[model samples]
Target: MGSLLSVFSGLFGSKERRILILGLDGAGKTTILYRLQVSEVVTTIP
Candidate 1:
């Protein structure tokens, strides 16, 4: 029981990890990821 509790606590205590975006070319994946990381507005044209 103590080990299970420790595992759960460890899992929940860590910070969120970096996001992984997978897509084909011209899919705006890079644009979106950058925008989120920088916390700023990003502009792009289709």
Candidate 2:
């Protein structure tokens, strides 16, 4: 399935774009992902 960001981007423009999230462990990658999917902040464990 496409990511939430991709879905939104498709609605705004024609050219497809991609994203890369780079961070060390426990840098809140999963937390950010959940926020993008749900549009809210959620508790996450590292």
Top-lDDT candidate index: 2
Q: Single out the weakest 10-residue window by summed lDDT for candidate 2.
A: 9-18
* lDDT scores of the candidates, listed in order: 0.81, 0.84
Q: All candidates' TM-scores? A: 0.44, 0.53
Clashing pairs in 2: none
How far does residue 18 in candidate 1 sit from its true spot (Å)?
Answer: 3.0
Best by TM-score: 2
* Candidate 2 local lDDT, 1-46, one digit each (tens): 5698888877897776687999999888888888988999899765
The per-prediction tally of clashing pairs is: 0, 0
Pairs that collide in candidate 1 are: none
lDDT of 2 at 32: 88
Tens digit of lDDT per residue, candidate 1, span 5-45?
Answer: 99999898877777667999898886887687797758766
